[model samples]
Target: MELETIRETYQSGRVVLINKPLQWTSFDVVNKIRWHLTRALQIKKIKVGHAGTLDPLADGLLIVCIGRATKMIEAIQDAPKEYLAAIDLGATTPSYDLETEIEQEYPVEHITEDLVIETLKGFKGEQMQMPPAFSAKKVNGKPAYEYARKNIDVTLKSKKVFFHEIDLQYFEPKHLKVRINCSKGTYIRSFAHDLGQKLNSGAYLQGLTRTAIGQFTLKDAWTLDQYIDKINRLNKYKVGEL
Candidate 1:
């Protein structure tokens, strides 16, 4: 089903920014787009790829490249990203997200909104951070998650990450809403996780939304349904008109 559609988009090179749905892997969406384009446009084959890999649990802008544009994927992936999230207090997860079970828990008291706001200032600049074990990062030529599945101990070195801004949003004194605009390697999950530790309260990401990636905003992106509709329209109408 996928190969049939890639052939069509191969005829005309174009790029697509898709608003990836939750639980859909980045590769899943990229392959689907490639295949959908080929079948809809009657191309023989299309090389499709995405700018970055968004965790299946996180939903947001995914820059997809078709044909020659695929070569420029890295440029997009290195761009800045923005995310809005809710941090759950009193618990920490191995994955730094709710997808993983609890690794540790802390007492919920002393978690005042003022303390949360003041603590955020410390994360606003550059810092060294270790990626969560249950992540896609490579270790000893293997993905970190692969090693995690085997229950093998893998020590990950901390990387320097730049945080553009970490602002406090609606603070409930328990769960907190915040906006994080940061560099490519900065992980909001780790930020929240570490923030909790610094405050003597464990933390995990309760919610996340990639509001933007570099210049691509959620508004200029397409849903799967909308992409399908556009492709069908192109089939019935002139490509120039589309």
Candidate 2:
């Protein structure tokens, strides 16, 4: 499609599926796209927002809404999400993920593959999950992570979340790979922590990737560089041609 056509569509509103890069916040992708769009379309400002917040340490599909499409954010966020997570057993972290150093360790010698599989079955269906301290959840009008980073104690209430499926994809001593299909607001990091507790060992999230959100899949998403390059190519199209 021509630059002019793309610009018009964006102005009218559109949904973009982005494959978020590792260590990049969901907001980072939105900001980058917004920056490029304003410059490429020669506009002072344009509305851009993401449907769900993906942790900076995790990577994968993110749904970004542009212009009038921004109104779709809430609905999209309500959709079910799928994730592939790697849990490192025999250890616990303050942040429940690699964002923090290992705070403690436990023996995983007794944790067999069968035990792991049985434990996973217990996680399926509905349950209340405590949001991690290092999360975007609000606490006294501030983000919970702010207090966590400062080592301040704060109470986070458990919220209801549903897990439709929890499948153990790979298993080895001290490590596990699993696929999860869950409702909105489910936190995989917390799941990792909880799983460890149930198994008489400790665990932390080692890696995570959001593979799908509702009907959207990572396979159809564009990389940030790919989208940016497409926008940069717009400079070659003259206003007179449109």
Candidate 3:
């Protein structure tokens, strides 16, 4: 439990893949898992690192590398991801999701299932998008989220992203469920935000769950507690014991 003890026994750069829990920052989970690993093995600290960062508001597969496996993080992030997201119409927000306050609202009387069908077809393509300022993306040497916190306006440049496929599951006038297969940097929040813009109706992400990332998926991910316990259980085994 002491810092020095951890430094002594913990190795650095091991790869772990975990399913992040809702409301816990990636770092919080990392540190908690670190504690679990040390306790299980009766060691100080094991070198552990994580792959892609998932927003606390989102939950899904997060690839982690412990010890030398840490080198694979970038490779993992480069892979595409799939998501099942819900877009709530008739409202708009600064951050595009539940992260910020609702900034505007629109009438939904004119929205229809037919319109939803037509609009979804239009989103299937390569396009340029402005990353949300409330995101972790860096701008001018500082995180855009930091700038947003200080109420400073940040200019974000548009970047190309592809939506390989978007299947409409359910579409009500005010709510829509969609399955999206997109590139690495794609933000479903931004996608929903823009969809509202194109339709001239305000919208925000009501809910989101990452289904797949590259070859990994939620179904294949270890729940947070399960993974932490795994580390504890791992130490009970001997080297070359697998």
Candidate 4:
């Protein structure tokens, strides 16, 4: 579609899939898109929101809704999500991911490929999961990470989440790669943390990529540069129209 046509649709509403860059928070994507659209369309304001929140350390598909489409954010977020995650065995961090420094290490000498495969099976289906302390989950109307940073302890309850599939893609002594398809609210960081405990070795999320959210795939999403270029094109076209 032409940039102008896209801009026109966006004024009312449109669902855009963006390939989120690593280290950029989900809000970053929304803000960027909104800023660009407002400039391209010469509009005073634009309603924009994201369907799901991707961690700053992860990258891949992010569903963005503009204008009236923002109302569908809840439905979009409820859909299943898929992720390619790299789990680091034998070491753990306070956040269960590289967002925090490793606080402890364990022996991986006893871990084997067969054992890892067997252990993965245990995570499939419905289970209760405790979200990481350094997460966006709210506690007493404040983000959990806020309290965690203050060195305050808060008891977080477990939530039910379902894992439809857990495909082990690779395995080594201390590195494991897996593709996970799970329900909403399923936290991959927590999964890695729990897996380490089950294996008698510490583990944390070394890497993560959100490959899909429902029918939206990273392959169809626009890169930040591409999105900006299109917006520029639209703005130029708007000048021609005037």
Query: For this target, which candidate reaches the highest lDDT against the unseen true structure?
Result: 2
Question: Estimated TM-score per prediction?
Answer: 0.91, 0.94, 0.88, 0.94
Model 2 agreement with the true structure over 48-129: per-residue lDDT tens digits: 9999899999999999999999998999999999999999999999999999999999999999999999999999899989
User: Residue 119 error for model 3, in Å?
Assistant: 1.4
Tens digit of per-residue lDDT, candidate 3, span 89-200: 9999989999898988998888888887788888888988788888989898888999998899989888999888999899888999999998888878899998887777
lDDT of 4 by residue, 9-101 (tens): 676677888888989999988898888878877778889999999999999899988889899999999999999999999999999999889
Clashes of each: 9, 0, 17, 0
Tens-place lDDT digits, model 1, residues 25-66: 999998777677767756666688888778888888888887
Pitting candidate 1 against candidate 4, the one with the higher lDDT is 4
- Report the error of model 3 at residue 46, Å: 3.4
Which pairs, if any, clash in model 1? 5-35, 5-38, 5-39, 6-46, 7-43, 7-44, 7-45, 8-38, 8-43
lDDT of each: 0.81, 0.92, 0.79, 0.90
Candidate 1 runs further than 4 Å off: 1-12, 238-242
The 10 consecutive residues of candidate 4 with the worst lDDT sum are 233-242
Lowest lDDT 10-mer window, candidate 2? 233-242
List candidate 4 segments past 4 Å from native: 1-7, 235-242
The pairs that clash in candidate 4 are: none
Q: Which ten residues in a row have the lowest lDDT in candidate 3?
A: 1-10
lDDT of 3: 0.79
